[model samples]
Target: MFIKDYISKDYPAFNASDSIEVANEVAKEFGYSHVFIKKKGFYLGALSQQFLEESAEGTLATLEHHYEKFALLDDGNILDSIKLFHTFNSNVVPIINKLEKYQGYLSCDDVFCEFAKYPLFSENGALLIVQINNRSYSMTDVCRIVESNNGKIYGCYISAFIEDDVQITLKISSENLSSIDETFERYGYNVVLKYYDDEKEELLKDRFGFFQKYMEF
Candidate 1:
């Protein structure tokens, strides 16, 4: 998926000449936290609601904090855009041409909708999560291991921890869980835990108890 597939054609935008008050109204009317600010149909940055509220200066263009990096979309796949969105921890990404002309915007909702079409997890498959110390943690080792065991890794996710380590989540479909576990363990990845839905009744009960208490509160 790319911005072409997920960006809303009707989404609101702003221009440099637009007053800060006008931007605020657009944000309020559309219920958007930020609006794409453009000039001569070229992508500039963004004007956020927080920027407006925190700014005492009435000048919209003079507000230095109103500027932010536009989430540039080159000729890339939807998965690539998803990675960028996650890396930046941003909700909206601006699409642009090679010459840096503004195209449109992609929202976080669109990305999740695209991913939800695929499987996030599966009980028929063994899920393994590995923790490492770098974002560049290679999946080649696990991919090779799964293939060697006649298994298939359906998807993978790599994230960083606050303590400088990285966390990898993998979804593997296999007939033998023990073999997969042994292979991952051979790679020095500590197995945190393992489970199947049939074995999760007790676990669900404990979790539900906590959820019930939280709901009551």
Candidate 2:
């Protein structure tokens, strides 16, 4: 789970005194938009690819004014990479220790691959998206609502916030999909979406219910 496990040294960190050409070569070679610069075994910051292309010739230290400051600690989880990836718009994210020593980096691809291994993404199940007031939600209540209806929740996360309400997305496995939907509504949850699989099973259930009602008469 720690970021250090996936740290890649594929892209080398540059010393500030290193030549602009050396940094440019590495940046272009790896197709990275930013290059990590270091001095005395500690990371200074990063200089964007655009800055290197514009400067005619100088040491990497000369481009100090153009450095962008951002990095993940080696101990941070891979999930932390998503925010940095969006904020910096970098193809690869740098990793550093608490002392600010440069560790390595994980590319955007690496982060995605790691995320794909999690049950929330990798598991096979239907997705239910429901909206409820902020004060109306709790993990226990949500889990109870799903499980009481004979559904098992694989995982759940807040999908969005609307005014004082929050929308939650849960990956769940269930045979009685309609029962789960009905249960959520009975509990005051606004079911925005129920992306269940196995339509044939649902159709069979409906037919069986019709037969039962007919026999009752």
> lDDT of candidate 1?
0.69
Q: Residue-wise lDDT of candidate 1 within 1-217, one digit each (tens)? A: 6556665657656777777777777766766667677778877787667677666645466764558765666565667666656665566677777777777777777777777677554234667777655654577876787788888777877744647666777777745667877877777765665654434666899999999999998
* lDDT against the true structure, each candidate: 0.69, 0.87
How well does each candidate superpose onto the true structure, as a TM-score?
0.70, 0.84
**Model 1 alpha-carbon drift over 4 Å, by segment:** 56-59, 80-89, 120-124, 131-141, 147-151, 157-168, 186-189, 193-198, 201-217
Best model per TM-score: 2
Off by over 4 Å in 2: 197-217
State which candidate has the highest lDDT. Answer: 2
lDDT string for model 2 (85-141, tens) is 888888888889999999999899887888788887877778999988999888788
